[model samples]
Target: MDTQHDIALTRALAEVPGPLPVSGVIHVAVPHASRFTVVGNHLAQHAELSLTAIGIGVYIQSLPAGSQVGIKALAARFAEGETTIAAALRELETHDYLHRTRERLANGRMVTRTVFCNQPGALLRGGAVAPVTVASVPRPVVTPVVPAPVVAPEPTPVPEEGPPPVRLPSRIAPKPPRRPLPQPREPTPELHRAASALLADLRRHAPELVLSEGDVEELVPGAAAWLERGAHPDAVRHALTTELPQPPKYPAKIVRHRLTVLLPPPLPGAQELTAAPRTPVTPFQTCEGCDRAFRSPAPGHCRDCRAQYWEAA
Candidate 1:
């Protein structure tokens, strides 16, 4: 492999191993704009192919640790709009940056490993690109949007028939048309009753369970019907215990109270606990060939450095 190119690749990878934005292009420059121009030109031209080929590598580096790579997640990062996940994954295999491993998850979903690009591959080592021979690749997944259910209108009621021959005209003038009666409000007695009952039951059975205002709001729906029927407090309590079998238990009360009590008083300008003392490690001799230091005990110098030192001697 070309050492200079390898060095540049490593440097660029170090700079952009994380999920970086396009704005990070400035970090690629070493010091001066002139040196940056030379490096930038090379990357923009010769290194572009390799850098672009490692699209999945860039993606793998960006992912959270232990997270299984999914096609949806890959697509959102790499393809975005220009290409589909299926296409990018296919190309990735061609570049030898990723491989698929099949397994069954606990939920019985067919799981696959989207391998990292750290392992040596022919193309990655500047070898020729090989043809992909895999029989099956995951297709681009698009979730379909489901429309809401349609409700049909109720049929109109038919009018009763009247006798046509016996028409007794009692009124000398035409009578005014009668207006339609307004629909009665829907019955909410059941709702109020249920809410009231639930509240009462909580107070009686699970008195230890401290409920917040939000919790009460949520519980009210259960006893709404009872509340609407002018339910007495005692009747509401009885109805709640009888109707709802589950007692109101606040699982988080102990946790909340514990948290409140255990909270340490705020220490303004408090210093952190002193770290444990560290034992002295063996001294490392400086390399003669390079600036790197080695931790070998009784070492004269690094092998490479010693060789250079001897050559100069």
Candidate 2:
């Protein structure tokens, strides 16, 4: 029974075909029945374009008319970052595969219009190629204009002249004046140092508040104004960092705004306020009379030793 089973297995193995060694890419073509996009070899096999650029070109070509193909949109759709996608888009534009035009609408709003060309080479060579349909939208037909026949001009008759027409100046509307920016006040050395330290420490509380050296210098005076106005360091910090925009785009701008808008009122008669009373402390002294440790104003003697000395004297 074992010999018969081994012979059957050997016969089955011989009947099966061996696996073929793959040296390169093997394509299995499947005919499309429904949704499909036809891409030309010129764009798919572009030598100058990077893989990312080629993929982006194919994607834009597959999109329907009036589709959003902006960098942010593409970045959201694909795993590529905005910078990489933006670079890819620039490559496509350079190769004439994509055209982007900024047009002002009838309502005075500006918008970007994008057009994709399937055969950019033919267009570059000045050859008329049929418009490539993207998705479902069809391209508009352009009509050629024929030149009108030229006619001879007739002689003009002289007319009685009246006063020259009054010339009117074109009406132009004056623009509105812009608001002036807040200026930083000159601060004392102590105030400046305190403000600088506070501004530098902001990043510890909120990483988004990281500031450059120039930014710290420029904003120091404003921060010093807050300190000079009797505002506590913690109060100023809270005002600058609390409820910060999800991620502060401009840390310096936010700092400047808080310093100006949330400035505390200066204390009235601040100089007249008396300092807090301190606890009385006795000085440590060694009594010469008794050679003992005591707490007294001077190192003369202890109370007990002083009484004894007076009596003995």
Q: How accurate locally is residue 302 in candidate 2, as Cα lDDT from 0 to 100? A: 86
lDDT (tens digit, per residue) of candidate 1 on 1-313: 6999989877786786466566636445333321111112222243424544445445453443455455665556554543555565565566455566675656555546455443334335675433222233255333222111111122223446776678788777887564321111344665645554455456556455455666555445433433443445555454333433245355234323322232233333424555658988988876645767887777456777777778999
Off by over 4 Å in 1: 1-53, 105-109, 122-313
Query: Lowest summed-lDDT stretch of 10 residues in model 1?
Result: 33-42
CA error at residue 207 for candidate 1, angstroms? 92
Clashing pairs in 2: none
Top-lDDT structure, candidate number: 2
- Cα RMSD (Å) per model? 43.5, 21.4
TM-score of 2: 0.36
On TM-score, the candidate that comes out on top is 2
Candidate 2 segments whose C-alpha is farther than 4 A from its true place: 1-187, 270-313
